[model samples]
Target chain A: MTKLIVEVQDLWKSFYIRHNRNDSLKERFISLFDGRRRERREVFWALKGVNLEVAQGEMVGIIGPNGSGKSTLLRVIAGILRPTKGSVTVRGSVAPLIEIGVGFHPELTGQENIYLNASLYGLTRKEIDRIYDEVVEFSGLEDFIDVPVKNYSTGMYMRLGFAIAIQLDMDILLVDEVLAVGDEAFQRKCLAKMQEFKERGKTILFVSHALELVSELCDRAYLLVNGQVILEGVAREVVACYHRGQIPIRHE
Target chain B: MGSWMRGLTRIIRYRELVRNLVAKDLKVKYRGSVLGLLWSLLNPLAMIVVYSLAFQYILRIPLENYPLFLITGIIPWNFFSGAVIASSEAIIGNANLLKKVKFPLEILPFATILFNFVQLLFALLVFFPAVFWFKTGVTPLILLYLPVLALQFLFTLGVAFFLSSITPRYRDVRHLTEVALMVLFWLTPIIYSISMVPGKLQPLIKANPLTAFITVYQDIIYWGRLPSTEMLISMVLWTGLSLGVGYSLFRRRQRVFVEEL
Candidate 1:
C-alpha cells in the first residue's frame, strides 16, 4: 500500500467567544470588584471528533457549508491550530496556502514580499533566490516587481500569493479557498499547477465550496457538517449528495 | 530536554526569518526619512546635551567627563527600554501572520530585540569617537565589550519574549511597559553615578538588574578598569534568570496565541 502522508484521528478543537472582552488589565481588575462587570464567554467547538487519513499522491477534497469547520480542519493540519483532543500525524512537510499573502508587508515591494512571504513558509535565502525569477515570471508581475505590494490590486496580490506558494517544493499542499479571488486565466493556471503536483505524486488536501470543481478534481471527498463527516466516498457521489441538500443544518 | 533541543534547531533553521524581519523593520523605519540612519544617533545626542546641562552644570554631578558616562549608560539603556517597549507589539501586531502561518512565533520578539540592537550598534558607532575626544582613553579591558554586550542582548531578548507573550492576552502591557521603563530609567544610574546615590540605597541600586550592566560599561569605557566580580556575577545571573523565566513562559503561553489573537 502507498504510505499515508496525512493522518488526523479523533480531532477536536474549541474556541471561546468572549462577551464584554476584558482584554485590558483595567477591565479585568474592575470586573473583580463589580459582579455585573464580569466578562462572559461561551465555548465554540469548531471541530468535533474529526478523523481523516490521506495517502501520498491522493487528491482529497473537503466540502462543507459555511461554518462547518472546513477551514479549521485545514488550519489544524497545517499545524497553525492545536487540537483540543486527538492527534494529527503528517510524515512530510506541508505548504499551507490557507489565506495566502499571509506575511506580505504592505510597505514592501513585490520583490521584497516574495522573499518575506517565502521565508515565512520556511524557505531559506538560497532557496528563495533560486525561485525568485520563476515566482515573478509566473505571477506575470515583472514590470511592477519593484513597486510596493500595497499598490497592487486584489487580483495582483492573490496572484503573487499563489505564485509564491506554488513555487515552494513540499510533500503536501493544503489549499483552502485560495482561488476564490483570482480571474479565470489565473484560476486555470492554479488548477494546472495543482494537477501537475498530483502527477508528481504530491498529496493534496483541498477545501472549497465549488462543488463541480471538487467532483471533477478530487479522487475522493468528505462532506463535513456540524463538525463531523456526514458522508465520505467517491467525489461525484458526495457532490451529488450535497447537491440534493440531504444533510441537516444544525442550529445553535 | 528534547523539546528544548527541537526549539533550538527550529530557531537555527529560521535564522533567516529573524534577519528578514529585522531588515524589514529597518527599511520601514527609515524609508521615508531624509536623514535615515542618522536619526537614531540624534536621540542620544540630544539627550546628552540636555543631561549635561541639567546634571553636570546645574546639579553638578561630581563625575569627570559626564557626557561620556551618560553616553555609555544612556545608549545601552535606550536599547533595553526600546526593545522591551517594542516587544509588547511584536506578537499582537503580527496577528495575521500568527493566525495563518506555522513558523516559529518566538522570532517575532527576537526580531524586535534585534532591530533595536541594530540601532544600538549604530548609536555606539557614532558615539565611540566622543569617548576618545573626552580623553577617557580606551584600555585593553574594553575588549570585554562584545562579551558583555552579548549578555545584555540575551537579557533583553528574554524580557522581550516575556513581554511579547503576555501582551497578546493583556492589552495594557504596552502601557505598563512604557511606565515601568520610565521608572526604571531613573532607578538605573544612566545620568548619575552610583556613588552619588544615598549610602542606605546603595544595595537597592546595586540590586537593580540594569545597574550591573550599565556599571560594567562605565568600568570598561569610562574608568578603563576591570569590572568587579559582583558586577560580573550579577550580569550572568540576571541574563540566566530572564531567559529561564521568559522563554519558559513564552513556550507555555504560545500554544494559545492564535486563539488569543
Candidate 2:
C-alpha cells in the first residue's frame, strides 16, 4: 500500500456577508449596534465538510465547475486559509503554484524577485544561490535577468514563475492551472517536467479544466459540484462523468 | 509553535525580506519626486525657519542657539512621528502579501520602523555638515548621548509595533494617534523653550517621554551639555516599560492577523 502523505477531514469554511453591501461610514454606524440578523451577512460557504486522503507518489486531479470548492480546498490543504471546521494534516514540504508572480515586486529586478520568491517558498538564500543559474536558464531570460520583472511579458512571467516553483524540491506540489499559461512548446516542457517528477515519486494535486491534460497527467480525479465532491476515481472516467453533467470549470 | 514566538523566529530567518521591504519603502517614497531625500532635510529646516521668525523676530524669546535647539528636537520628533504613521498602516498596506503568504508578521512593523530609521540617518548626516560649517565644537559628552538615542529608538519601535498590531482591528487608533501626538508634540518643546514654561508644567513636561527624550537631544547637540540624572533614569524606565507592553500586544494579535486580513 502507498504511504499516506495527505489527510483532510470535515473541512468547512463560511464567509460572512455584510448586510449593507454598500460599505460607507454612515451605513457602518447604522449596522454597528443593529441585530446581526437584521444587518444581513448571508453566509458564503467556500467549502463544505470536505474529506479526502491521498497517499505518497499519487498524481491526483481536482475537476470542478465554476463556484466549485476546488481552489478553496487546495488553499486549505496548503495552510493558506483556515477551514471553518475541520483539519488537514500533511507530511513534508508543499510547494503551491497557486499564482506564480503573486509576490513579485514591480521595481525589483528579476534577480531580486528570484530571491524573494524562493525565500517565500521557504528556500534559504544559499539554496536559491545554488539553483540560481538553473532557474535563470529555465526561464530563458538570461539577458534580461537584470531588468525588473515589471518589463516581463505574460509568457516570460509565467516561465520565471514555473522555473522557481519547479525547483522547490518539495514532497508535494499543489498546482492550480498554472501550466495553461505558456505556448504549446512550453506546455510540453512543463508536462515533461511533471513526468520526471513522477519518476521521483513526488505527489501532485492539480486543478485544471483541460480534461485531456488532466487524464494525461493524473491517475485519479475528483469532481466537485458546488461545494461537494460529486464523483471520484479514474481521471478519464471522472472527466467524462463531470462533462456529461454539464459542469463548467471557472476560467481565470 | 505558538504564533508569537514563531513570528519572532521567522523574522530572524527572513531578515533579508525585512531589508528588502525597508529598501522598497524608501525607494517608492522618494521616487518620481523632484526633491528626493531633500524632503527629510526640508522638514526640520522649514520648522526651524518658522520658529526663528515667530520667536526671535516676533515674540522675542531671546533664547540662545534657538534654531539649533529647534532642529535637534525636531529631528528625533520627526523620526518618532514617521515611525508612528508608517507602522499604523504597515499591516493594512501589505494585506495582499499577508493574505497569501506565511511570513513572520512582526517584520511588517519592524520594517516600518527600520524604513524611517534610514530616513532619520540621512537627516543625521546633514546635521554633521551644518555643525562643522557653523564651527560648533564637538564634545565627548555629546557622543555620550548615543546610549540615550538608542533608548529612544527602542521606545519608538516598541510603540510602533504595539500600534501596528492594534490598528488593524480598531482603526480609530490611527485618528486617535494623530490627535494624541498633536497634544504630545506641544508637551514637547519642539518649537519653544522648556524653560519658558511655568514651573508647574516643568514636572509634567519632564514626565512626558518625548519631551524628556528631545530635551536630552537639545542639551548635547546645542548646548554641549549632559542630560540631568533624573531625565536619564526616567527615560530608561519608560523605554523598558513601553517595549514590554508593545511586545505583549504584538504577541497577542499575530495569530488572528492572518484571519483578519
Q: How well is each residue in B20-99 modelled by candidate 1, as lDDT tens digits?
A: 89999999999989999999888889999999999999999899998999999999998998899899999999999989
CAPRI class assigned to model 2? acceptable
Model 1 CA lDDT for position A41: 95
> What are the lDDT figures for the candidates, one per model?
0.92, 0.80
Best by lDDT: 1
Best by TM-score: 1
DockQ for every model comes to 0.81, 0.28
| lDDT of predicted model 1 | 0.92
Per-residue lDDT of model 1, residues A51-141, tens digit only: 9999999999999999999999999999999999999999998899899898899999999999998888778899999999999998999
Worst 10 residues of 2 chain A by lDDT: A18-27
- Which parts of model 2 have CA positions greater than 4 angstroms off? A21-42, A246-252, B1-6, B31-39, B129-136, B166-180, B200-207, B228-230, B256-261
Tell me the lDDT of candidate 2.
Answer: 0.80
